[model samples]
Target: MDFVLVHGTTQSPAGWDRVAKLLTAAGHRAIAVDLLTPRDLPVEGYAQHARDQYDGERPVVVAHSGSGVLLPAIAEALDARALVWVAAYIPDFAGGRSLRDEASAVLEPDWIGVDPTADPAKASEFLFHDCDPETERPALDSLRLFNPAVLAAHPAGAAPEVPSTVIVPTRDRTLRPDWLRRAGRERLGVTPIEIDAGHCPHLSRPAELAAILTGRA
Candidate 1:
């Protein structure tokens, strides 16, 4: 399947380096797009660009973290065959709340210090707990800073009928695992595959994560 990999907040297309390489090595075509700034533009205008620009048939829409909000629209617009979510916020039709609202409401971390904005210190401190110094170290250096103004803006929810699979990180500080699992059922009405990892399992445990994605697990 043609894979359209999307990075989460404060993350660029570069975040998918290891996973993309593995996909290529295995002969699966995987393309990672910058969720923070696609087409050198803001996230608000993503629905338009993806519709007109994407070139593929039955593309598997793989979205991570905050980027999950826009997948239903992209899939609807681009006519995607399936959506593969990796520790993403795959909410139902009435998507719980905006990322900004959700962050402000929760008490996650001091480094997270606040909502959805990029903070390398916080990332290293919170999100990458399972990852090693080598794994978290580089990601810290290249942390993608989103347009805070855009993040604070209201979030449009994903479509209800879009076919999707949610991959839950059982222990995530960035997003509650229980919350994601509930959303996967309540919103998507689908049972999710729960994994014991942090936010981005594709980085920390690529073999298992990929096996789950490729369905050899």
Candidate 2:
């Protein structure tokens, strides 16, 4: 299947390095996109590029992290066959609630060090809930700094027009499994698959994640 891999907040095209390699090796076409965000444009503006790039291909959209906000827009614009969300932010596409607000409200008050004031890169731990030290070390170290604006916008959650798959990182603290399901997956006909990993499954569990994508698991 042709694929469009959308990285989470502030993530450039390099973030999908591992995923792109795996998908291509499996004989699938993958287009890893880097939307221009953190600029003066609105989230809708970024969403437009995601739509325009897809052309006429019914590609599978794999979204991670803060890119969750764009799902509604992208899904609406493209003739999407399927979407696989990896530890992504699932928001109310209609009410337009920021993914950040939804995640903060869902996480219990006990989880501290969330650092609402800190940059997204420094707060990487919140996304990788149960990842090993090795898998997370470099990712956390190279985390690109971006403002919270990506997650602060209203995500079009009224309803998604396409079928989607939501892979919940079981240990994800950034976008909790429960919240991800409720926020959008269940509404969008997505079969929520639970994986024993942290936020970035493509980075740490490429084989398992690829299997799921290929329908072998």
Candidate 3:
């Protein structure tokens, strides 16, 4: 099966390198997209970018973190076989709330900053604390600042009709596991698949994450 991986904000396709390697070894084509560029575009533009890059037949679309908001449109456009949310936000379609509102409600006091990418150290602490120093260093250096307007904008269109799965990282410091479970159930109507990892499981537990994605876990 083909897997289209959409990365979170402030990150690039490189973040899925390890997980993609594992999926490829298992004979599945894994395509990781970089949604950080053209930072001026809104959430719809990111969804269009993802849809434009996919050239396979009904691939399973997996989105991480903030990119989850784009899945509804991407799935509809691609006629995706399934939608997978990895430690991701399941937007409340009924509420018409933006990603920024959800983020601000949960922002840690230390996370307060005008520019999220300005301090690499704090970014690492928030995102890659569980990653190995060697792996985390380059990721930190490559971090980019995504336009806040994307988060502030409401997700375009309603949730798609594709079957969905939510992967909740139990050890994620960025998003609480309980909140993910509750949100996943309330919004997506699916129970989450729990993993013992941090926010970036593709970096910290690639093999294990791949197993789940490949139906071997």
Maximum-TM-score candidate? 3
What's model 1's overall lDDT? 0.68
> Which prediction has more favorable lDDT, 1 or 2?
1
Model 1, range 95-193, lDDT digits (tens) per residue? 546666666433245535443335555676566778888888766654676544544444656464646788988877777778777777777778998
- Residue-level lDDT of model 2, residues 101-214, one tens digit each, is 565665544443344225544446465445466756645543554434655655555666567778887776655567776754455666688888866777778778887887
Q: Which stretches of candidate 2 lie over 4 Å from their true place?
A: 51-56, 93-96, 107-124, 127-142, 148-150, 155-157, 184-186
For model 3, the local distance difference test gives 0.77
Compute each candidate's TM-score over C-alphas.
0.82, 0.78, 0.89
Q: Clashes in model 2: which pairs?
A: 92-157, 93-156, 93-157, 93-158, 94-157, 94-158, 96-154, 126-174
Q: Lowest summed lDDT over 10 consecutive residues: which window, candidate 3? A: 106-115
lDDT of the candidates, in the order given: 0.68, 0.67, 0.77
- TM-score of candidate 3 against the unseen true structure: 0.89
Cα deviation of 213 in candidate 3 (Å)? 0.8
TM-score of 1: 0.82
